[model samples]
Target: MTAPHDVPDLTGSGEYLVPDVLQPGLTLVLVGTAPSGISARARAYYANPENKFWRTLHAVGLTPRQLVPQEYATLPQYGLGLTDVAKRHSGVDAALPGEAWRPDELRRKVEHYRPRIVAFTSKRGASETLGVPTGKLPYGPQPQPLDWPAETELWVLPSTSPLGHNHFRLEPWQALGDRVRELRGAAEAGNPSPETPVL
Candidate 1:
């Protein structure tokens, strides 16, 4: 697979199932385990109709209006971004190869972009990225990993995938959205954003 000419190979591996929609100064970056088959085929994040990601973003006030998958590239204007752990693969979590979950590369991206908050859309992605067992990870804010930028925060949200319906919850996502809005409000007010909690 060849990297899209328009999207720089941020990681330099030269390919992505779905090009990352990311840039510096984003308020939030939604990290997923990988694109679903439908999304990879569409070359857009959360393209699957059954996925609740797009709706959830609007429901939580992260996006002013509901956006279809095709509008993913426009998220940065709303202070949001998107990427996945398994960039070279696309499928359900179980089918992904071990090598595809590149936590180090994700860490590198986070260190460089320094988004105010990084939220994993599923426990599995959070676990793989943080090296913590999924059973130990709670929803919502997470402890900042060592060596991460001081101004950056981390969060874990329930997966919006229909396959994860049994465990899906909106409260955590709502909390994150609320925090994102708070930060934006503070920045717009020319006030120092609230301190990131130690937890």
Candidate 2:
């Protein structure tokens, strides 16, 4: 197997990061607040082996195949895109210490990309980045979708953080996966897909 890469420091860096392996007009875009320990080392957001991302997508039918860590960037081929709320890496999400992600940049991404869905990997990302209240924000299109938003669906599911509710990733994953299914349908129909996975 190939080795993972290390995360670059967030301090004093200037870059307008877009979703990893995002295809123009992709169906869904997965977001995180920033890189995690595993992702930082792997140089791919959500590259952690323990992360249920691919398995959940497979279960929900977004991906017709399985993927190892290095293949994460290839997710867009299966109609998925990866990105972070904050483009920097701070080893752990908790290490973020505060609102490390910028809402303006995220809004800009949404407006520019106009992805069908925007899903946050964790509630922290949604709360810290998106204007959502924390803790289990639900499993469908947000009740109050943004007007200045990218016309993409927004959602805030449970945190995929290893430090989060360690035992219940699958349940939330399944629910989120179901939502993804709906978004994919919209994408296939050329309608506004209403689901975006956020970190």
Candidate 3:
């Protein structure tokens, strides 16, 4: 299926495969490499039925309940947000064009929104953003990149995409959920949470 031409990119870069669901002051923001063909056609993040993204959010306690991809716009109410490194592309990672991955754009968004935590749904996205080789990127929290805001934390999670079955592991996702809850709790109590250690 082709990406819908009617959707406009607010950033003026071009048409977005799936409009980003984001806002300032979110507790967490999940970043992906790009929308899959199915997601682009649906104009929703992780719209494929086989994709575990939505279910994992609830299973890991990031959301109160499992959310359909169509309900993505409501994530801010739950202190969650979403975006992709390749806004104009829609396909599997291997098929994406080199120019489509704009790590700087993602950095600007994260710096502006100031979410408490930013987790990459796949190592490829994180690797591109951090300029590290995928083989060197480990799961869970990572060291702060140079010039990254100290208040915001970075994490790497296994891809929820069906194609990522070989690399998928529930443990890292669970750890991320637990850490998000901790940060939320600390914020609710008006206490400063300690920095999350790299896992």
- Predictions in order: lDDT: 0.88, 0.63, 0.86
Q: Name model 1 segments beyond 4 Å from true.
A: 1-8, 11-13, 197-199
Clashing pairs in 1: none
Q: Sorted by lDDT, highest first, which candidate order results?
A: 1, 3, 2
Question: Residues 1-199, candidate 1, lDDT per residue (tens digit)?
Answer: 1233433467334689888877778999999999999999998999999999999999999999999999998999999999998898999998888998988777778877889999999999999988899999999899878777778899999999999999999999989988998899999999998865433
Worst 10 residues of 2 by lDDT: 1-10
Model 3 segments beyond 4 Å from truth?
Answer: 1-14
| TM-score (all chains, Cα) for each model | 0.92, 0.74, 0.92
lDDT of 2 by residue, 97-199 (tens): 5546676656655666667678777776777665666754664446545555535667655665556647445665566667667766775799864535433
| Stretches of model 2 off by over 4 angstroms after superposition | 1-19, 97-99, 145-147, 165-169, 186-199
User: What does candidate 3 score on TM?
Assistant: 0.92
- lDDT tens readout by residue for model 3, 1-199: 1123322353333577787777668989999999999988988889999999999999999899999999998999999989999998889999898999988777777766688899999999998889999999899999888868788999999999999988899999999998988988888899988679656
Point out the worst 10-residue segment of candidate 3 by lDDT. Answer: 1-10
